[model samples]
Target: MPGDVGPLAVDIDGTLTDQNRALDARTLDVLRAWPAPVVVATGKAMPYPVALCEFLGIDSAVIAENGGVVVIEQADFLSVHGNPDAAAAVLADYREAGHDSGWGTVDLINRWRETERAVSRDQPLEPLEAIAADHGLVVVDTGFAYHVKSPDVSKGQGLETIATQMTFALGDTVAIGDSRNDVSMFEAVGTSIAVGNAPESVRAAADYVTEATYADGFLEAIEWVGTTD
Candidate 1:
């Protein structure tokens, strides 16, 4: 089972895009040609990645909101993970702490930016810590969203669910990504590939590194798997 391959979990953003936001066409074509199923595991909100997957012509599951949410179909939301009550409690705690910390839309981003400047001498985590402390939340430093996730909800768990449903052994999985949030998926799968564009930490943890980006990176990964034992 470990030798047999299964579904691949690929991340978006830095891995798929260059410094500017553009999907590599060649990479996209390679992914479309993959013999095994492809599942997109991302930290972006559902709608964004769902749209990306749709554009990519993928018909697989999308793990979004950094595993706080999962969408099996473009229209259906699968609450496979994340604790709503805990998330709410954290939100309330942030507000009560006078930080006005909560996740919403562009409004929240601006508010956090202001708060970020006011607190911690321009350190973002100052207010971030205040919010986390109030809510009793585990803060994942993604350098973007603070990621106030529920204890059990994660990309790894979501991948496991899909693997089980597909009758794919966990030991046969290959997870790829570029962000720190992807660390969980790396740990959960038998093989993990980090893109050339991945962060230093991510690259260090991966079993292999792709010479390509997006679908190209995915294609390199497949080739690596084919050649390795």
Candidate 2:
């Protein structure tokens, strides 16, 4: 069954990195020898995941911005959400509501994002969801940050698009993640693994939950999937 599986789609940030946000050397070594195609999916900016894929020698499509943008062949940026203006407006509303918002870091906070906008998750989700709904956008929690994008866009849709292009069935892909944003991909794929650091809701949505956190958890999930029938 391991041979039957297609590419391995892994989430960056909390799933790939430790608490300090750096990739573990041991995990990187495992990725270097990974048999299947590895796709980097994350709520971080497109460049971050793409660069990591390049470093790991992974030449597959990357799902970025909580599935708002998909990068194919490390060249073109396919906008899955296609509503950057609306996303920005919703973020502006969040700011007006006295919530701190930014696009990741303070320096690039004002920079324009083509598909999705990032905000602090410290704010209540209900009010933010209402604002996003008003602008036809969806709010996703990425553990570290909250992303606002189009309702039609999701990690599930991103994974589906990549699977179609790569000529693999959605069931053949294994999605690994550790946050609420990964729930979409969890629902899309036949096998979904959640890291130990994942919230309770995320763990419940996953087919299996790893005993370890961060990259250790990632490796655990990968080995389990490779050995299980």
Index of the highest-TM-score prediction: 2
Question: What does the lDDT come to for candidate 1?
Answer: 0.65
* Per-model TM against the reference: 0.75, 0.87
Off by over 4 Å in 1: 1-5, 73-77, 84-123, 210-223
- Tens digits of per-residue lDDT for model 2, 33-145: 76666778888777777788788777747888877788778434365565888987887787788765743455373363578777766667777888899999888777787
Residues 55-164 of candidate 1: C-alpha lDDT, one tens digit per residue: 87877577776776666663354654555455556555555656544343444332311011111112346656656555555666553456666556678887776676
Count of clashes in candidate 2: 0
**Number of the predicted model whose lDDT against the real structure is largest:** 2
lDDT of each: 0.65, 0.79
Candidate 2 Cα deviation (angstroms), residue 143 = 1.3
Candidate 1 least-lDDT 10 residues:
112-121
The clash count of every prediction, one per candidate, is 2, 0
